[model samples]
Target chain A: AQTVTQSQPEMSVQEAETVTLSCTYDTSENNYYLFWYKQPPSRQMILVIRQEAYKQQNATENRFSVNFQKAAKSFSLKISDSQLGDTAMYFCAFNMNRDDKIIFGKGTRLHILP
Target chain B: NAGVTQTPKFRILKIGQSMTLQCTQDMNHNYMYWYRQDPGMGLKLIYYSVGAGITDKGEVPNGYNVSRSTTEDFPLRLELAAPSQTSVYFCASRPRQGDYGYTFGSGTRLTVV
Candidate 1:
């Protein structure tokens, strides 16, 4: 069985500050993928970033980046220069390279305070 | 382009009633999925399809049915709505069978009384 865990249920940081959301997963498969998704109040799931287990280099998109440690089975999301719009529920996700299912973590409610 | 579209943004069903949650994708994706999101429970896969006419049960498929008659459409049917079925439902699609590039639709909030 595969599972993703987001340790933090909620977090708050001042705008322009950097915040990191922690995530860890338990999976026996060596080949897999990790993803971070953002769900705003509108109930839309937006893909923030993704990383391949085989890739040693972390994935970065604008102010969003992932620290993917395959051996530790840890994948975390860091939001730099966070803005008010960055406030939302962030979820860490996992999927096997060959499997059709994508598992998701509980989620961390992030608040960017001005 | 409309990445993924789910109809009936909100619905309320009485116990024992039945309804279909519609989902469609214009991206010509080969894969589609239906999942339910509960508070503090990320998302549970209810049903998924590899392509048109190819549907399968997922992690939590009980009390739910699905059909994919066309590549672009995957609708989930609830035979008998129950209080436990109240939650937000999401539809997603991707172009390939691989686990990446999933586009999610704005979820439908369903409440069964």
Candidate 2:
């Protein structure tokens, strides 16, 4: 079974500053996918970024980027130049090789301080 | 595209009551999933369907049942609700190809009293 773990319960970053949410997963399979999802107070879950296990280069999307360390089974999400809209509950997820099942970590409550 | 939509934004049901949460997608996606979210805990998959006639159980499907009669709709049924079943449910869909991320519905908040 694959399990994702987010150690940070809460994180805060000043506006325009950067913050990173830590995530780790346990998986024996080499082929997998890691994802970061954001849920605002509106309660909609949105995909932030995704990293393929085989890809060495981390995934980056605008202000959202990921630090994926396959050897350590660590995949962290970095938010650069944080904005008020970035304040939300961030979750880390893992999926194995086209598997329909995606396991999510507990979650990290992110607060973008203005 | 109303990608995915879940009906009954919020509901309160007494224990042992039965109700169905409706989900529909406009994306014509082949895969649809049902997940439950508890406070502080992330979403956990309850049931999923690969296509109209194919369904499967996920991490937590003991108390929930699902049916996929059409490609666009996948409804979840709670035969006899329990207090532990109180949680926010989300419906999501993903195309078999050409997309990586799953399109998720807003969610259905259900409380069992």
Candidate 3:
């Protein structure tokens, strides 16, 4: 079974500061996809970024990016120039290539202080 | 696109009561799913359907039931609601074949008293 572990349960940083949320997963398969999702106080789930296991270059979406270390089984999200809107519960998810099931980590509560 | 819609944005049910959480999508997606998020926790899969008339249990389907009568609608039913079932439920959908993540609903918060 694949399991995702998010080491940081909660974090706080001043607005305009950069923050990174760490995530690790256990999987035997080589071909898979990693994802970072954001859930604000509204409780709406939004996909922040996605990274393919075979791709060496990490995925970047505006201010959000992922450091996908496939060999290390680590996928972390970095928010550059973080803003108040970046405050949310971020989740790290995994899905095997072409598989319907996507496993998720507990999530890291990130707060951007002003 | 109204991607996915879950009804009763919030609800309160008493013990042993039964109710269904309605979910529907406008994207014509072939796969639909139900997941529950306990307070300050990750989402857990409750049930999923590949298409109309094809439904399967997910990780935590113990107190839940689901049916997919049409490609657009997948409703999750809770029998004899319990405090443990008091969580926010989200419905999501995706195309049958692709790594294109999931389109999720705003979520329905259910409180079982």
Q: Estimate each model's TM-score.
A: 0.96, 0.94, 0.97
DockQ of each: 0.69, 0.52, 0.67
Model 3 docking category: medium
Candidate 1 chain A, poorest ten consecutive residues by summed lDDT = A94-103
TM-score of chain B of 2: 0.96
Given candidate 3, what's the lDDT at residue B68?
Answer: 91
lDDT of 3 by residue, A1-114 (tens): 889999999999999999999999999988888889999999999988988888999889988888888889999999999999999999999998867878899999999999
Model 1, range B1-113, lDDT digits (tens) per residue?
A: 98899999999999999999999999999889999998656888999999889999998999999999999899999999999999999999988744575899999999999
RMSD of 3: 1.0
Docking class of 1: medium
lDDT of 1 by residue, A27-54 (tens): 9998888899999878799999989888
Candidate 3 Cα lDDT to native: 0.92
First chain of candidate 3, TM-score: 0.97
- Write the number of the candidate with greater DockQ, choosing between 1 and 2: 1
Q: How many pairs of residues collide in each model?
A: 0, 0, 0
Predicted candidate 2 versus true structure: per-residue lDDT over B5-113, tens digit per residue: 9999999999999999999998889999999999777888999998999999998999899999999999999989999999999999988622266789999999999
Scored by TM-score, the top model is 3
Off by over 4 Å in 3: none
